[model samples]
Target chain A: MNARAEFHDPATRAHLLADKARWVREQTLAIHRRAPETRVASSLSAVELLTVLYYSGIARITPDEPLHAERDRIIISKGHGSICMYPILADCGYFPMAALETVCKPGSFLGGIPDPIIPGYETINGSLGHGLGVGSGTALALRTKGKAQRTFVLLGDGELNEGAVWEALMFAAHHQLKNLIAMVDCNGRQMLGYTDSVVNLNPLDAKFAAFGWQTHTVEDGHDVAQLLAGFEALLASDSPKPKVLIANTLKGKGVASLENAPLAHVMGVGRAEIDAILGDGAAP
Target chain B: MKTTMRDTFLATVLEEMQASPDVVLLSADFGAPAIDAIRAEFSDRFVNVGIAEQNLINLATGFALEGFRVIGYAIAPFITMRCFEQIRVSLAILSQLRPMNVTLVGVGAGFSYDVSGPTHHCIEDLAVMSALPNLSVYSLSDHTQAPLFAKHCLAKPGIKYLRFDAKPHEPVCDAGNDGLIERGFRVLNAGRDLAIVSTGYMSHVAWSLLPELRAEGIDPLLIDLVAYNCVDTAALEAELAHVPRTLLLQEAVLDRSIENTLRRMAGGKLEAMGVGDRYIFEIGSRDQIHDAAGIGRAQVLDRILQHHAALA
Candidate 1:
C-alpha cells in the first residue's frame, strides 16, 4: 500500500509482527516495573492486539502529527489495560521512548490510565464503556463527510458489562457505519474474578452478529499471526455493517503466576518476576 | 400563540446548520416542531440516537472531537442526570485537553414540565452543572433571548449547557439584546433599596413581584442571570455594591443552586429562596408547587416587604 507497509508478504509480516509483539510485551513489563501502579497483567493481555494494529500497518497513522486529518482514528477504550500501547506508540514515533519511564509519575502524561494528553490517544479513556459510543459517532461523522477513513475502538471483555456499550452497538449498526471497527480484548477477567462468574459474556460473537454486526472470532489473541489474519479479513470486508473482532485472550497471556489467575486484573508483577520473565533480552 | 424557548433556540440552530454544515444536531429521541424542519432540510446532519442520553452525549463528544460544532437535545433531567458521568468525563474532562464545541440543549428547566411530576423537574442542573469547570451554563429566561444565546453557542468553542423551559411566556429580557451575549446578564429594572437576582423561570416570578414591592415603598432592582458561570462577576458585584441587601430567587433546590454563588458574592448580605430539601409530590400548577415549597409570588413579596422594613 503506502510506504509505511514495511512487509508486503503476509507470512513475512506475521513473523515480523510476532517479534514486535514480544518487544512490546517486554517494554510494557519494564514500564510496569518502574510504575508499579500500572495494571501490568491487563496490559500484558493486549500486547498482540495493539502490536498487530500498529505494526501490521492495518491502521493508517501519522505518528509525528498525532491529529493528522487524513489519519485513522483509534480509541483505546480500555485505558487502564492498555499500558502496552505506551511502548508501541513510542516506537512508532508518536512520542519519545524515554517518556515511557515517567509513567504514573507526577507531570507525566502516561498515568495509571492513558488519557488523550498523550500523543496518539484519541479520547479521554479509563472510564469504561464510553469509547465505543464515541467511536461510533466519529465513524458516523466520517461517513457523513463521505470519507473512507475508519475508526477503531479497543475495548476490554469485562467492559461489555456496561449497558452503554450495547447502545453504541445498536447505534452503529442502525447507522450502517461500515467504517467502524471494534476489537474486544476478551481477557475473560475483571477486577474481582472471572468475567463469567461476574457476568457472562460468552457467545459474544453471536451476540454481535445478532445485533447486525460482521463478527470474527480470533481464537488465539496472543498469536500475532492469528491476530494479523483476523484484522486483515475484517479490514478487507466490504460489509455495510460495523465489524468486531472478538479476540479471545487470557487475562495474563504470558507469565505463569498471572495466567489463568481469576484476580489477575488487579494483580501486579514485581520487578524480580519481570526480570525473570524478560531475562537477558529486556532491552528494546 | 406564544413560542417556546426550545423552538426559538432550535430555529436559530437550524439557521446555523444551514450556514455551516460543520454544525451537527443530535436528539435522544426528543423532538420539537422546529426540529422537524431541521430533519427535513438537513437529514444528513441530524441524528435521533434513540432514547439513550448516555449515547447522545458520547456521540456529541465524538462529533466535537472531529471538529464539528454539535448540539445534543434531550429532556433536561435525563440529559444531565442520567448521563452525568458521560458529560463529566467526555465533555468536561476531555474538553480540558481538546478544543471541543458542544452545546447540550436541555429542555424543561425547573418546573417547566409542571404536571409531569418530580422526575421531569430539572432542579439540580444549575448546581451540578456549574460544579464542573470549563462548562458554560445558560439558564434562559424567555424565548426572545434564546436566539441570541443560540448564536453565541454556535460562535463559541467549548462546552455550553442551554437550559430551556418547556412552557412559553411573554418576552422578559427584550431591551434589544445589546451586549447581552457579552455581559451574560441584563438589568431588567433598576432600584437602590434591594437587588433581586434570578434566573430562568424564577426571573419571571421575581419580576412579577416588583409591583407589590414598590407599592409598599420598596425600591427593588431585578436582574435576569443568563450565563451562570461566566457572567461578568465583577460587574455584577459592582451592581450589588449599590444595594444594601441582595435577594436570590431560584426554582432549584437550595443545597446546590446558584444561591450559593450569590450568597458568597453578597458576602452574607443576601437571603436566598428556593425549594428546600424536598421533592413536591402534590398535583398542582407551578405556582401551587412554588407555594408548597414556600417560594410562591406571595411569599417572595412578603420577603421583599420585610427587607424594605429592615432597610427603614
Candidate 2:
C-alpha cells in the first residue's frame, strides 16, 4: 500500500496537502501555546510550504534514517521562524510525537531553534544567512560525489539582506548547481518591521534571476495547492541553473491580531488566545 | 631558504590532491603561481570562491561535513577575521559534534604585504584564532613545515588555521627538528639567563641575535615556537622555566606574543615585542616597518643584549 498514494496522484495531491496544511497550522499554533518561546506567527508563514515539500513526495527523506547519505538535503535557515517543523518532523516519525511536549524544556534536544541534533535538520541554523551558502556546498558535494540528490534551503524574505546569501547565489549559479533549490518564505516582515521598510528587496525575482537562478514566485504561498505545483515544477526543471521559489506569504498567516502585524515575528501567543483561536473554527 | 611559503604549501597540497580523490583545495580567488597546476589537474575538486572570504569558509565547512578534506585559502587577515563568525559557528562548533578535517590556509602574514598597508597585514590572527575553542593555529616560517601541516590535514578531524608569510626568507632551521615541531617549541640553541622565543619570520629575527649574544659570553636560549594551541603547555613551560628570562616574539600584534600566553599558563613575567597597536602607514619594506615599530633585528638585538647585561 502506498502511504502517500492517496495524495500521490495530481488530482488529489492538492486536496491532501490542503488537509495536511490545516492540521499543521493548528499543531504549530498549539505547539506555540505550549512553548510560548517559539515564534508562532513567523512559523505560521511556512506551514504550507513545508507541507507541500514533505507530503508531495518530492523530498527523499526517511524518519528512520534522517541522516541517510542519499537523502535530499534540507536546510532551514530561519531557525527561529521554523517552529512548524516540530509538528511536521514529529508526524514524519523523525522523533516520538511525545517529545514535542518537551520543546525548549530541560534535556529536550528540540530547542527554540532547530539544530542538527534534531534528526531531520542538516546543520545548525539558529544563525541566519548560513543555509544557502552551506546548502550550495552540499549541492556541490553531491555533484562531486556523483550522487543524485537535490539540496534545498529555506530562507526568510528578510534573510536576503545578508550579503552572504548573495555570495551563495552567485556561487551556486556560476557552478551551474542545478540540484540546489531555495524557497524564500517572503513573509514581508522581519524582526523589526516590514522588510520593505527595513531593507527594501523589491523586485525579488529579478534580483534572483540576475544571479542566474531559475526564479519563480508563488503569488499565494499560503495556498497549499499553489505551493505544491510551484515545488513540482522547480524540482522537475531540467535547466542547468539553480532554482529559487520566492514564496510571497504573510508574516502572520492566520490569527486576526497577528496577521500582517509589524512586530509579528516576536509576538507570542498566550494559552487563552490559543484556546479562542482553536475554538473559533480553527480558521487559518 | 628562498622558497616562499605559499608556493611550497600549494605544491604540497597539489601532491596530496593527486594521491587522494577526497582532498579539495579552495581559494577565495587568492592564488599562487603553483596553485594553477592544482586547479588545472583537479578542476573538479579545486574551487575558486571568487574573493569572498565569508562564503569561502562556509563552503569549506560544507565540503568538510560531506567528508572531504578541504583547504580554504585566502590572504591571512581576511581569512581569519572577515568570516570569523562563520569559522566560529560552522567550523569550530560543528567540528565538536562531527569529525571534520578542514584547514584554513591564510597567506600574507604580518608585514609580508607591507606596501599593501594594514588591511593586507595580518597582525592579530594568532590571538583571535587561538580564542576559538576547537580551532588549531599552525604558524610556520619555512618550507620544511609543510609535511607536518600536510599530515594534520590528511588525517586530523578538526578545524585548523595555517598562517603563512608572504615573503620567502632563508630557512633558519638546520633540519631534523621533529621533536621541536611535534612538541610545538624547541631550544634551537640552549643557553642560560634569558630565552629568545619566536615563530614564523620572527624566529629568524630571534636566531640573528644568538651570535651577538654568544660573542659577549651571554648564552641566552634561542627558541623557535613552531605551532600554536598545539603545544604541550606544561612541557613548554618546564623548558622555558629553566631560563631566568624569556623574551616573547611575533610579527603580529603584541597581544599575540607567547609571553602573554605563557603568563596565562604558569603566571610569569616576560618582555614582549612585535607590531604595536598603531597601523603601519609608513609604506616601507617589511624590515623598515618592523624598524619603525621598534621590532626590527637591530632593536631586537639591542633588547637581548640589554637583558643579558641586566642578568649579569
Candidate 3:
C-alpha cells in the first residue's frame, strides 16, 4: 500500500527480514510446484536477496508506477534463476497475486524466464553477462539525465566466467560508477556442478578489488541480517568505485533433498515432497 | 569522394551527438580517425566498450530503454557473429516490447577488410542481420549514403543495422537529388530487355558496366538497392514487372540474399548475382574473392549477355 523502505531499527529489521525470507521461501516453492518449469534451485538461492530488495523497499520501486524515472533501477541478469521475483513482484503490487498461479502457463507474463513485460523488471534477463553492462549503461544515463536514481543489478557468480561480464566490470570501474551496485548470488553450484570444480572463481572479491570496485562479502548470504547489512552498505556508499557484494549462498537453500546437491540446478521437486513441504494435499 | 565509410559514418554520428544530448555513441575499441573527433567532442556519451561486442549490444539496449538513442559501432564480422544472440534477445526482441532506438554501425561490409583475412571479411553480415526479426537492414553502397542514413537514423526507432564498407567509394551518380536514395531503391539507368541490381561496393561494378553494355547495344536498367531487407518490395516488384530480366548482385552468399527476397516479391529467380554458400579460405583482393565466388563483373556480364540473348 506504501513505500516499504528497509531503513528500520536494526533489531526490528532483522526480525522482519527473517520472517519475510521464510514467507518468500514458501511462496517461491509454491509457485514452482504449480509451474514446475521454473528453476527452483537457482530461484531458492536468490530468495533472501530479492526478498530483502522488495520487502525492505530498498529498490525504490512503486508497483503502480513501475517506470517512474526517479525510482532506482534493478536489472536481474539471471532471469531463469530468479523465479522468486514472481511472488515478490506480486506481493509488491506490481501485479496481482493470482498471476503467480499462471506462471509458465498460456498468456502468463510470468514465464520460465522473467521478461520485462512483467512489471518491476527493467532490462531483459535470462541471457548471462548482460546485466552488469546494461546496469552500467543505466547508471551512466542517470548521471547524464541529472537524475539521482541508483542502478542495482543481480548476477550469478558462475556468470563471472563470461568474458563480457569482465568487459563490463572494467568499464564500470574505469567510469567510477559509484551509483551502480552489482551483487552476485554466489551459489557455488552452476547448472552442471560446483563452480570451483567447473571454472574456479575463488578470488572473486580480489578480482573486483583489483578492478577498482569497492567489494564486500557476507559469510552467510541466506542470513537476512547479513544480507540487509550488505545492501545497506552499498546504498550508503559514497565511494567513487562501483560497489559489489558477493553474497555467499547455497544453490538450493531450504529443501533437504536439493540443498548442496551436485545436480540441484536441474533437480525438480516431485509432488509428494511438495505436499510434505507445504503440509497440504491441495494443489499449490 | 576519397574517405572511408567509417569516417563519414563517425562524422555523421558526431553531428548527431552534437545536436542532441540523448544520442550516445559506443564502440568496442574499434575506431577511425573521425571517431577521435567524436570521442573528443562528446567524451561523456562516447564509450569504448573494449573489444567486447556482447557488452556493446547489452549497453545499447539499456541506454535505449532509458530514452537515449544509442549507436554501437564495431567491425562487421565480430559484432554480428560474436554477439548474434545478444542482438537477437536484447535489441531485436526488446524493441518489439518497447520503443528501442539502437542503431548498430558495423564497418567492414563484405571484403572491405580484405587484408585482415577470413576472420575480418564480413560477407555473412547481410545474411544473418536480415534473418533477425523486426530489424531494418541497410547495406550502404557509398560514403555519401552513410552520412545520409546517419541523418535519417537519428529520427528513427527500433533496431537498424547499417552495414557500411570499410573502404570509401565514389558516387556512380550525384546522390544529392537522387530520389532512389530515400526510396530504398533507385533505377540508375533504364532499359527494356534487362536490369542490373546491386548493393554496396558491387554497385560500383554495376555502374562501370553501363558503357560496356551500351557498346553491346544493351543499355540495361541499373537498380541500386541500398536498403536490402527493409526495401519497398512491392515497389521493387512493380519495377521488375516492367523489366524483362533482372540480375541481383551482392558480395554475400546467395541464401537469404537479395535474390531470395526478389524471388518472394517478384515470383521468379532473377539470376542471383552474388557469392554462394562457401568460405573464401584463399586470401586475395576483393575482386579475386568475387571471382572465386562467381559474382565477379566478368562473370556477371557473361550471365547477363546470355539472359539478354535468350529473352531476345
Candidate 4:
C-alpha cells in the first residue's frame, strides 16, 4: 500500500480529509440554506486543522465509538466555526451523515455552534474566550487524577480580546499543564473586519511566549503535511508548558465566492449560492 | 446537632473523593475554617482560586468537564450573584445530563456579614438561587442542618448551593431523629393559628418565639425551609392551609424571600417580616442590624401578632 492508501484504507487517517473538507463546505452551505436570514460562513482552514487533529494527530476516536475515556479532548472555542465541525464529526463517524441535515435546526442538538450534547464535542462554547479556561480546568483535573489524556482547544484569533482567556492562559502556564494544547485559527478576519483592524493581535507568538507557552506558527494552515508535522512536534516536545499552534488560515477557503469575503464570516449564503458553490445535489 | 453542616459537608466530600478521586474543591479565598480538615487530608483535591469569583466559577466548570466534582466556596454574594452566569452554563445546564455537583459554600447571609458592608451581605441570594433551574439551594437553619444538607448535596448528583453563617449557630432541629433535612421541616406546634416559615439563622429566632405565641393561646407553626430552590410546594401549601395566616421570616429582603415563597404556594395570605426594601444606612453589630431590620425575635413576634390581629 502506498502512503495515501495506507492512511485511507481503514479510513481512520487523513484519507477522510477530503470528505471532511467536503462535509464542512456542504454543511456550511446547508446552514446558510436553512437560515437565510442568519449570517453563516465556513472556516476552511479550521476544517483542515480538525482533519489533521481528529484524523492523524493524538485524538483517540473509533468512528463507530466516540466516547473513549482515554481519548484526547478537542474543544472548539471559536464556536462559529462549528459550521465546519458538524460535518467533520460526521466524516469521523461520530454520528450519521444524515445528522448533518439538522445543523442549526430549531431546538436541535446539532446547533450552529459546538455543544457537548452532540456526542463528540467536549464543551458548549458559543461565547468566545471561555474554552481555554475550561480546557485548562480539564487539563488540571487530568493532571491531578494522574490521567495522561491530552486536551486540544481551537480558538479564533479575534477571541483573544477576552481577559478571561488571558486569565486561563496565565493559570495554565503557571500550573505547567503539558497535556493541554491550544491551536489559534488565525483567519485574521472577524465579524466587523480584519482581526488586526479590530484588536491587532499581530505579536501573537511573543504574547504566548510571555504567557509561558510553547508557541509555534504554521504558515500554510491548509497544508495537511505541515499541520500533521506541527502536531507531531508538540507531542514530542519536552517543554513544561502548554503548546499553542497558531495556524494561519483563510476565513472562507475552497469556495470561490466566499474565499476571503469580508462578509463571509457573518453573512449567510442562499440556496442559489450553495448551488453555485458546491453544485446542485452535492450534499449526501 | 452532633455534626455541624460544615463538618458533614467535608466528611461527605472526603468520602465521595475516596470512592471517586475526580472530586475536587475550589475556593474563592474563603472557607478556611470549614474546609481546613479536608485541605489537610486531601491537599491535591483542594484549590484556592484566589478572590476572583468569575474565574472560580469558570474554572469549576472546566474541572467538571474534566470528570471532577468541583465544589466552589465563597461568601453568598460572590458565589451566587457574581458568578451567576457561569453556574447557569457550566453547572446547571451540564448537571441536567452528568452529575456536575458543584457544592457552593456561601459563608453568611444577611446580617451575619454585617460588618463587611453591603457588598458582602447576601440578602438576595435565596431569590437569585431559587430563580435558577436545576440548582439545589440549602440555607442551613443551624450547625446540624449544615452538615446534613452538605452531605446530602455531595451524595446527590446535581448542582447545589449551600449558605451558612461563619459564626456558631444554635442547633434548632435534631437531624438524627428527624431524617436529613432533604425538604422543608415543620417545627413548633403543628396546626397552629399562624405559620412562620423561616430559613437559615433566622429560623433560630422564629423557634425562640414559638413558646411566646403558645402562651397567648395562639399556637404558631414554625417551618424550617432547608432547601429554598426545591421547597416542597405541595407540603408547604398543606401546612399553610391549616394555619389562619402565614408569616415568612428571613434575614434577606422581605420582597425576595417572602414574595418568592408566596408566589410558589399561591394559596396563603402571607405577610413578610425581614429586612425592609431599603439598604441599612447605619453600621452596627449583627444583632443591632437584625433589630433595625425587624428581624429580631421580639420584632418578628410583634409583626406576626399585629398581622394576625389585622386579619381578625
For each candidate in turn, give its C-alpha RMSD to the true structure in angstroms. Answer: 10.2, 10.6, 9.7, 10.9
Fraction of native contacts under 8 Å reproduced by each candidate:
0.57, 0.39, 0.44, 0.38
> For every candidate, what is the interface RMSD in angstroms?
13.4, 14.1, 12.9, 13.7
Each candidate's lDDT (Cα)? 0.88, 0.83, 0.83, 0.73
**Position A87, candidate 3: lDDT:** 79
Pairs that clash in candidate 1: none
State residue B144's C-alpha deviation in candidate 3, in Å.
Answer: 2.0
How far off is residue B244 in model 4, in Å? 0.8
lDDT string for model 2 (B1-312, tens) is: 588878877888888888889999889998889988998898899999998999988888778878899999999999999999899878876676666889998898888899999899898999899878778888887767766677665677788888898887767757445675558776677787688888888888878887888898899887777777678788788888888888888998777457767777756445667665333334345677688778999999999999778869
Report the lDDT tens digits of candidate 3 across residue range B211-263: 88989999787888988887888888887887878898998876755666787
For candidate 4, what's the RMSD?
A: 10.9
By DockQ thresholds, what CAPRI class is model 4? incorrect
Q: Which one wins by DockQ: 1 or 3? A: 1
**Shift of residue A183 alpha carbon in model 2, Å:** 0.5
User: What order do you get sorting by TM-score, best first?
Assistant: 1, 3, 2, 4
- Predicted complex 3: CAPRI docking category: acceptable
User: Cα lDDT of model 3 overall?
Assistant: 0.83
Give me the candidate number with maximum DockQ. 1
| Candidate 2 per-residue C-alpha lDDT over A1-284 given as tens digits, one digit per residue, 9 for 90 to 100 | 32344668887788888888888898888778767888888899999999887777888777778878878889898888998998888888788889877777655777777777778887877778888998999889889999898898999988889999999999999999999999999999988999999999999999899889998899999898778778878888889999998898987788877895799999997677778878853443
Candidate 2: misplaced stretches above 4 Å?
Answer: A1-6, A280-284, B256-312
- Residue pairs with backbone overlap in model 2: B1-B171
Better of 3 and 4 by DockQ: 3
